[model samples]
Structure formats: C-alpha cells, structure tokens
Target: MAVTSAETARPLALVTGASSGIGYELARLFAQDGYDLLIAADQPAIVEAKQSLEGLGVQVTALQLDLSKVEAVDELYAAAAGRPIDALAANAGHGLGHAFLDQDWNDIMHVVNTNITGTIRLLYKVGAEMRTRGRGKILLTGSIAGLMPGSFQAVYNGTKAFVDSFSFALRNELKDTDVSVTVLMPGPVDTEFFERADMLDTSVGQSKDKSDPADVAKTGYEAMKRGDGDVVAGLKNKLQAAMAAVTPQTALAEMHRGMAEPGSGKN
Candidate 1:
C-alpha cells in the first residue's frame, strides 16, 4: 500500500543534480508536465530547489548525496521505494581546470567517481528495472565538449565522452523495448557550476554569454518525452557537434587549449 507503482496515472521522475543549473531547470520542467519529482544533488541548494518544485504543485523529495561515492547509487534507488520512477535524468556533472598532470589525485578521483562510476552504476540498475517493467525513459546529461578534446579540462570532457557514447549504445540495445534513452548534449550554460567547480577563472568557464539552463533542460526533456536518441541544446553547440565529426582529434585538442587554460575567461 505504501509504494506507488509505475502503472499510476501520474508520471514520476527522478532527476540527479537537481540542486542548480540544468538539473534544477529539468525538475521544474518535469513538474510543469505534472511529474512528481525525486531530486538529488550533493549541494545544500537541493532544499531550495525542492521547495520551488513543490510550489509548482509537484510532490518533491530532495536528498543530499555525495554522488561521487559508489555507495550513493543504491541508496538513491532505495529511497524511491514508494515511487515507481517513470523517468530518470542523470544530469549531475562538474568541471575542473588546470593541467591534468598538476591536479590533485583526490580531486580527479572525485570527478571520475561522480561522472563515470556513479553515473553508469545508477543507469545500469535503473535500466534493468525499466526493462522488466517494459516502460520508462532515461536521459543522460552529456556535453558538446564530448565531441572534441579538452586541454585543462581533459577529465571532465573524457567523462562526458563516455556518457554520450554509453547512452547511444544503450539506446540501441533497448530498441526492442519501450524504454528510451536520450543524451542531452548542451554547450555552456549560465550557471554557478563553473564557480563551484573552481573553473570560473578560465576562459571557457568565464563565458557568461552562455545558454540558459532552463532552455537546455527544456530541449532535453522534450527530446526524452519523444524518445529522441540525442539532442544538442544550442545552435552554436550544434555547429560544434558537426565540426567534431570532420575535425582531426589533434586539431580539436589544440583548439581547446586556450579555453581550459587558467585566466582564459571562458566563464
């Protein structure tokens, strides 16, 4: 009697990284679409974000999680016992600047843990559940940067590369099922992500002239609702994606050097 099954009339969505930026906007968009939300992010801001979603008339659950920790994935799914998630948006990600060689081991591990290990683990479990139910939608937050190379932000871009690639493969594998996987590949967004990631001083991070997270999230959600395999959020980023197809890998890395370098002003 306690659990709300997936057969319910109202859709329920679980969004990671809902504390701010694109993740926060996705929760709002889903709420407007009448989906109840289970939002998770490591930051304290999830409290405010959840309150905002509740104000939109959606049932909201917020959790503070260090998603970088491997154990957090199961805990997140367990927390959803009473709710059958119709959709899962894996939108939490972070960036780090400075030369990869010079970066702290722990910091790099933290990013890798969250972006790679943790994300894939959750996706696997959630995908399995959806497969059994024969219904569900999943969205992974990827980046246009995944197409090319990242200089100082190498690890971040590499992780996104994994996400985008993994999403495509998973989508194909589930082609026979009702479950759909969408990879939201967005360019820069005007959010506090850069500030918090400590990349605000870099050229790419300092680029305040970025896409709105709300707009980006809208594109992703709509695409997921339609079961589109992938979507690039901005026009400029779309062009970047096009170039990535033809450009040489070495050339792309060189191009990214100035942007990721410190004092480059990409925020």
Candidate 2:
C-alpha cells in the first residue's frame, strides 16, 4: 500500500499477529492514539482487522504474511516503503502442545521460526532504522510461561525465554540511543492460543480465569509508551514471575506438567 497523505502527519506503528487477540487490541490502541497502522497476520482475518481499524479514522494497511519465513519479514519491512516507523509491536507468535517427541517436527520448527527467528529478524531490521533516527519504541510479546520450564509445551516456552531475555539485552544495547525496547510478559490469556496450539484439553487452557487480551495489550502499550524495560501484564502473573525467579527448575516443570499435560483439564 502507498503511503497516505496523512502518513507524513501521523506516526505509524507496525503490529504483527494483528488479526485478533492481543495483537488486534494493540493495533486498536495505536489507532485510538492517532497512529496510522501497518498490521500483519498469517491469516485472512487481517483484512477484517484493517476494515475495523479504519473506522477509527486512521490509515490502516493490512498484510497477510507468514512471518515464520525470512522473506516474509523482508516483505513486511519493505511495505513500510521507507516511511519512518514510530513503534513496532512484534507480537506475532503461537504455541505447540504435547510432548516434544510426540509433536510433529514441522510444527516444532514453525513455532521456533515464528516465535524467535522471525521476531528477532524483524527487530533487527526496524530497530536499526530506529537507532539511526535516534527515536522509536519496540514492544515484544513475551510470556510468563518463559519463566518456567514447560513440560508439554517445551518449545513454545523456550522460544519465549529467548524473547524475554533478548528484549532486555537489546534494550541495554540501545540505552545510549533514544530507541526503547520493552517486553510484555503475560500469563494465560483468553485468546485462540490454546485452541490453536491444540491445548484446549489442558488445565490452563480450560480455565476461565485467563487475562483479557485488551487489558494485556493496555499494560504492554502503556509500558512501551513509557519506555519501560518490561511489564508483566496482570497481578497474578506478576506474582508468578516473582516466584519463578526462586522456583526450582524441576518443580517448575512439574507445575507446567499439571497445567499443560494433555487431558490435565479433565482432572
């Protein structure tokens, strides 16, 4: 999409995985705050998101791109068309369930590529430009799950661990510059995450007490605006994060097993 006449006046935010859930909520928040949006997702729902966000009176460009591939990430950056990006919410990621050995190898690789490889590559691309300009904000959607050793959801948690760690490292690297990096670590959230990961039969997946995506988005967005290094979304998650620091790795894995092991919801 061509840059609109308003693009010069309004700051732009690129939000990935924006077709639904936290990504969509983040995009909505940006629109509400007067940011033109370039939002992407791997599915057709992105088209619907653009239509909905346009109601807020901002130029919304939607792309359906699989961020798991290197080429797709490049295409997304090119879509910016050399326009300055004021903020980037690299929130595109998904999970996989079941034992690592039991899960399909392709699915595992896809999860890693989406959650870690693509995320890091996009950050590198946009973050460099932001550093050169000396101003920008970046928010990465990490997970409280990263704090623990996931038994049934090992690969997904491992990827988030990388995100949670990488965000802080990058933030420090840019400390001398105006570019800000913040990681949003949220616990179980009410989204299609469980269903998509085929974890609906797990305890955490079936629980009704998941954090609302809007609230999570707000927590992350506000922290990004403030240039905070990190923000864990909810009180429960905050407590969990605090405890995880002291929790034994074996115990944490056991806890995850109780919540994520297939059919644990039936207990």
Candidate 3:
C-alpha cells in the first residue's frame, strides 16, 4: 500500500473497487468533500485512480488486491492502521453472464466469493469496529437485478439479493447507534461492467442508454450521507423494482431471460 501521507485530521473513507466506474467516482466525491481515501481494487488501475484523486489535493492510499480472498479483506482493514474509517463503500463485486449451469465452476464461485462472501466479511469486520466506536457509515452497491430472479445471470443476481437484504438487516440492527448502512441498487449503468461480465451479446448489455456511473455514485453517496436504508438509482429502475414487488417469480425470471439471454442483442 502506497499512502500519500502518514496521517492527518481529515476524515478517512475506505472505498473498495475504486479502480474505475462507480467506485472511482465515489472516491472522487469523497476527495472533493475533503475526505482522505484508502481505496482498493483487484486491478493495477487502482494505482491510476490514486494519481487521479491526488490531483484533488487529498491523501490517497491505493492497494491492489483481490477482495474475494479473505486475506485481502483483512489486509484492507489492517491498512486503516487503527485510524478510524469514517465511511466504507463496500462496492467490490463481480458479475457473470449466461446460464448458471453453462458457466464454469470457478467463474461462478468467483462471482459468489467476490460479491457475497468478501463483501459480508469486510462488513462484519468494519461494522464491528463501527459498533464499538458508535459511529461510521457503510454504503453497499447492490443492484436491481437482485429484486428479480435472474435468468441467464443467476449467480450474480443471487449474490446481489444477499447484499440488498443483508444491508437492511444490518442497518436495523444498528439503528440505536450512530452507525448507518445504505444500499445502492441501480439498473444497468454505462461502465465496464457489461464487458467484464461477458454480457455484451445480451440486449441489456448492448443497450445504448445506461445510467452514468457518476450519477449513480452521486445517488448512492447522497443516500449514504442522509442515512437512507436503500436507493434505486434511476426512475426506470425504480419502476422495475416497484413492479418486482408484485410480479410472480416465474414471470420475473422469464422476463429476465429476454433481456440477458445469450445473443439476445440480435433479436
């Protein structure tokens, strides 16, 4: 971990998956607000993100580590060096496209470990610390996909469902304290996610109109600051989430198939 400074009076925020997309944007918002950042991602791009954020005149510590592994999560927490983590943006996750059974076993587990296991583990560690101090903020990046039964993107959706539900449960458990937890559930966004998830051949992936990541990050960041339980990023996504509440499970799965099935973009 390369830190820009030793320590300071500024509040510290730890943001995971900060290499790019929503995570990077969230870190940028924190920097602009005078928060020092401890940012992590599995890719070398985290280093680049550090340089970019430093231009905002905030100290940034960048760690390149795969959060799916338990050791990595511990390393990230330890990097705090006993300094209080005022906020934690637990945004690290992985996505996979195609039918569940058709996907490789390793790839499937990678998504599970990254999106569910690692996220919860880090939350547990950080949440405990926050509880002890009686203060902190946590923002989780869930998805609208979690509300429905994903057809081709089964494992990814399952992981997000866990995230969305877990965040609410944890928030209620900590309500008496000043600690706050917020979940950001967004629809498709204009990011590298579609390409990385291998969903480019699907209709949802190929669509021209996707929410801007910066905008999505802003929604999440503001909701976190306000201590909201959860927020759906876009109007279209909010309507979809509202409908999922009344729609039958089988119908939701079938609808998802049309959007995420392999090569559905050509239809």
Model 3 quality (TM-score): 0.98
Q: Which numbered prediction scores highest in TM-score against the true structure?
A: 2
Ranking by TM-score: 2, 3, 1
* Candidate 3 lDDT, 178-263, residue by residue in tens: 99999999999998998999999999999998999999999999999999999999999999999999999999999999999999
lDDT by residue (1-267, candidate 1, tens digit) is 123445657788889999998999999999999998888999999999988889998678788898888788778888788566789999988787788998999999888889988898888888898999999999999999888898888999999999999999999999999999999999888998677667878877877679998899999999999999999998899998999899999999988987778778733
Between 2 and 3, whose lDDT is larger? 2
The per-residue C-alpha lDDT of model 3 at residue 253 equals 97
RMSD of 2: 1.0
- lDDT tens readout by residue for model 2, 120-187: 99999999999999999999999998899999999999999999999999999999999999999999
Clashes of each: 14, 0, 0
TM-score of every candidate relative to the true structure: 0.95, 0.98, 0.98
N/CA/C clash count, model 3: 0
